[model samples]
Target: MILAPYYFNEKTNLSEQPYRNQKRRLEGRSIRDLPLYSQELLDRIRLPAERDLNDDPCWLRTYYDPSSEDSWGQIQDYIDTKIGGPVTVYNDSSLYNFGSNWEKIFLRAPQLLDNTCLFEEYEEYVEEALEEGIESESGDAQHAGENGYDPVEDENPWICFYSEYLFRLAAGHIYIVDEKTLASEGPDAGTVLVMWYDECGRAIRYYREEAMHAAEIANLAPCYLKDYACWDNAEIGESYEWGAPLGPPYGENRREASE
Candidate 1:
């Protein structure tokens, strides 16, 4: 999902006359010709990377017209035909949006405040389970207690609780549609069509009004949490073993984990 500017043959000057003469046939050009045709021009025109049309958010333009609301159905239809199955279209707010993004939302620090009531319930459950250690006759509940009853030590307890609440919070936000349903009938709006097709192309989870652009999701979420959080008695240059420093790029332990 991370995209960078892919370069084309720099010696080819496409803007002058040869390419402009083929304007009518531009739609017929394949994605392989994009660097030689489109992005070079976009960069020549000085558009930012987010609007570069080659990136994820803008890349949707290659599939359907963002300006057209009806394109959603066209998207579903194309997938259906390719997959040879009935296509189902749901809005971005539908039940089909559950995925990695939903998990990230719950795992973020801001979620601790967003779902306070659920966290309180988790705390109560943990307290009760710890108190009822040996005598709890419930099979699964008793089994959970046998593992030393440490929520922090045995990551499963909090994971189970967080996952349940995350599912509840994410309901009606995930959307699903049939494969290749994207180009249902045909598009009249002149939006780009699919540049590439994979038989195993997974359904993309999207938001209605928000693009969930990579920069916004990956960079902004942690900073937003830092801004709203309390920083009492915070010391600088202290190498904490758990979390990163209270600022943007919250990834102090990231390299350690990867290593």
Candidate 2:
């Protein structure tokens, strides 16, 4: 969903962590207390009811600021702390460059998908590529073919070709979340959270699977759908589960069941 841009009323003050403070302020408050932009985003996401919040792993939310230099590091730290090791970051398709590169990387190293790797390998590859003046452009692969260099023949095609994108993933430049992996692996394997942010980088939200997970990261409780103004309008039949339809079931299966 296309979310409206959100801007902070106050000026940017890096002296203190403004985003951290904002996250703290949002805790324990009704969704009604949230700014209109935040409320609108939450409404579009359609959170579950308060009664199901604890039982439903999909209803949790967290907070983080991508604009902050330290925020990515903290996210990595959180994932590491949860999993006891570094995670193989997966980017949303919305992250065009990272997503495309990830597809290529997966083709070359399918075993690495959703698996941890030594951070040193990513770092070393990046340093060597930079020293060699290897262009990260998409056209570079085509150019290499003309020069008699075939990347497919390489033992480590991911390292030989898309190492730059791998570096970005390891460095946390791209946002990463995979729901299925999180579900199968459990929180100890690492929890993934969806993030939303305004174009101006003034506001950010982390949609998590547990309130404690969110609170631990933001150091504050998260706002819930119960606090939203539209919560009262939610239909009794609405499942509020992630990826579930908003209304009564009406697919072919429903017809067959009724018959």
Top candidate when judged by lDDT against the true structure: 2
Task: Specify the poorest-scoring 10-residue window by lDDT in model 1.
Answer: 1-10
Of the candidates shown, which would achieve the greatest TM-score relative to the real structure? Answer: 2
Over 14-59, each residue of candidate 2 has an lDDT whose tens digit, in order, gives 2222323453566687778889998888765442231112211121
Candidate 2, residue 29: CA error in Å? 55
Task: Write the residue-wise lDDT of candidate 1 on 64-139 in tens digits.
Answer: 2343346555543444443332222223332224332322222211111122222324434433432232233222
* lDDT at 258, model 1: 36
lDDT of each: 0.26, 0.31
Candidate 2 regions with alpha-carbon error over 4 angstroms = 1-66, 91-247, 250-253, 256-259
